[model samples]
Target: MIEYFDRGAIVTSSLCAEVMKKMRNEIRKKRQGKLEKVLLFHQDNASAHRSAIAVAAIRDAGFEILKHSPYSLSLAPSNFFLFPRLKENVKEQRFEDNAAVVAAVQEFLGAQDEEFFKKIILSYKKFILKVYYNKCDYVEK
Candidate 1:
């Protein structure tokens, strides 16, 4: 699900907590209340993500956050995969408003199939191995 924040809105700890709750709820619904597998979440080390409130929310939702290094581009799937594809799709396009931009993003996300996401997850394993073999140094594409 794509959530859009208001223009110029700062992602505070409270907002992060709220978003985490919403994400958990969405996942529960999608799984039809049967969350059999452990939830492993990966996110950038933003201040809000590490804040007490957000951490509590994540724990409350029973999510195990994957360890992420600060400013590590290789660890961010969005940087190496999603965003570039999204940019290529929306490049040279002008949006009238924030809503339009959000719609475009939502459209792009909606167009991706399960295989697309599965491929990303599979690629993440390779990336992790590469990072490990390189002693945590940056792994270029």
Candidate 2:
């Protein structure tokens, strides 16, 4: 969640590997190395990120992993923002191709104004601070 890039969408490997590979090939034709120069990876202390296999792939691909960002199960933009919207969108359309999904996302972003984004970004500080307190105290789930 921490490492979002303008050029790519997040995907899991089992179902999405071939799709991502095909998509990447097409994307290279369109953007042509635009995303190759620098890639940002954000991962938690998950074994996927720490594992030798995962680390090797990232290093080979030349993506810079931003490892220090604060992490929590209760807080992720996918949980908060993109996932719900994607669900809703899929419900409305049954299913769509990846490009169609991308278009829908673009429409979503276009619908958001700067002030709205600023408000959300501003709340990030408070969000993290609140979690700090929550963790310090042994509050029940």
Candidate 3:
């Protein structure tokens, strides 16, 4: 699921809730019969991400939140994989404005194939195992 907020828009709990609803619908539509009954949703413990309303929205959408250890920012899959790829794609390219930046990000994200996402998922699993083995200590990325 790919989405961008409007320029200067604040990402409050309400906005995150709405985005999650939209993303859930998109995922459901795309997966159709293949959609699982239980969805494991992952996100960092940002204030907006952990807000009561956001949690309620996620539960309402039938997702089970995957918990992360406190202060385990490095364990975030996007930090290890997704954003790095995005930064690489947009690197050295000049955008006219916020919309252009958003468009560039969308284009880069859209270009990624299923194999790329599969690889990230595998890497995430490996990272989780590594963290478990290391007693939940922050492992080097």
Tell me the tens digit of each residue's lDDT in model 3 across 1-141.
767667777889998899889988998899987985799888877899899999999999889987776757876678877888889878899989888998888788788899999998999888888777877777765
Report lDDT (Cα) of residue 76, candidate 1.
67
User: Residues 1-141, candidate 2, lDDT per residue (tens digit)?
Assistant: 112334464444322334334444554677875775665544445554556666656655455654433445534534544456557755757334666667766777678689866766556446545655776332222
Model 3 alpha-carbon drift over 4 Å, by segment: 133-135
Q: How accurate is candidate 2 locally (lDDT)?
A: 0.52
How many steric overlaps does candidate 2 have?
0
TM-score of 3: 0.87
Give, for candidate 3, the lowest lDDT window spanning 10 residues. Answer: 67-76
My TM-score estimates for the predictions, one after another, are: 0.86, 0.45, 0.87
Q: What's the best-to-worst order under lDDT?
A: 3, 1, 2
The digit string of per-residue lDDT tens for model 1 on 33-68 reads 688888987777778988999989998988997767
For each candidate, the alpha-carbon lDDT, in order, equals 0.82, 0.52, 0.83
User: Which candidate gets the maximum lDDT versus the true structure?
Assistant: 3
Question: What lDDT does candidate 1 reach at residue 131?
Answer: 74
Off by more than 4 A, model 2? 1-46, 50-72, 85-91, 136-141
Q: Which is the leading candidate under TM-score?
A: 3
Give per-model CA RMSD: 2.0, 8.2, 1.8
Question: TM-score of model 1 relative to the true fold?
Answer: 0.86
